[model samples]
Target: MKWLWRSIASLALGLGALGVVLPGLPTTPFLLLAAWAGARGWPQMEQRLLRHPKYGPVIIDWRERRAVPRKAKWMASALMLSSLVSIWLLPAPMLLRWFLTLFLPCVALWLWSRPNS
Candidate 1:
């Protein structure tokens, strides 16, 4: 189980790192997942994440206060919504469009509900 969690964290961190360069990919969420998983499965990785210069503060804020910076929230929301809209408008399958339609707004609501860090 621990190894499974560590693998999940590693994969999430890789994707999050990639998200740094990808236009619509979400960096913070995956990083947050990595940090959470690492805490249980890989303490060293957790420490490294918490010690990171840019991502650390955001993680700390979330862990300490369940908050997210307003700028991050807006950016995440915009990217999520725009991606959803694109999928909705494109020739994607009905199931994918419907899933996104239901999912993205819930994500937005959760994001917006977080207190600003």
Candidate 2:
């Protein structure tokens, strides 16, 4: 069980790191997941993540307040909109496109509803 949690932590952390450099790949959610998993299996890793210079504050803000930075909210919304446009332009099926059309707005609404950090 510990190993499984550790594996999830490692994988999520890797993806979160990649998200830092990859446009439209969200960094905060994966980092949050990584921290959650690390807490279960690896206290040291969790501490390290919480102490990170760049991401630590964001994580702490979320854990303490369920807060999302306003800038992050806007950026995420923009990315989602761009993705929806790209999907619409592709030869994707109408059902999938429609699903995203409905889902993305709901997600954006929820994100916007969160308290700003």
Candidate 3:
């Protein structure tokens, strides 16, 4: 199953890379998955991710402390807010807007509660 894990790792890494540049595409979760799969299938790949300039510290912080960096927390919250605002301003149904209005805050709360690493 090592080959299967390696394939999953490769796919997750690719998606994580795309997430880094694509708005609304989350990076950390995918990177986290990649790291897990990489550890099982390709040790070098996992090490390289752990050594990545941008995402390495984040992965390590999460693994070691289950924490989020303050900067990351702020950025994520801001992005969520912006997305909410965009949704509000769009021509979507009122119910959809209401759902997002309620949902985004709950997401923000969870994000804010994480210890800063």
Using TM-score as the measure, the top candidate is 2
Model 1: per-residue Cα lDDT at residue 83: 88
Query: What residue runs in model 1 are displaced by over 4 Å at the alpha carbon?
Result: none
lDDT of 2 by residue, 3-60 (tens): 9999999999999999989988999999999999999999899999999998888899
Encode model 3's per-residue lDDT on 46-111: one tens digit a residue. 999999998899999999988998877888888999989999887889999999899999989998
TM-score of every prediction relative to native: 0.87, 0.97, 0.82
**Which regions of candidate 2 are displaced past 4 Å?**
none
lDDT of 3: 0.91
- Models sorted by TM-score, best on top: 2, 1, 3
lDDT of 1 at 85: 81
- lDDT of every predicted structure (CA atoms): 0.93, 0.95, 0.91
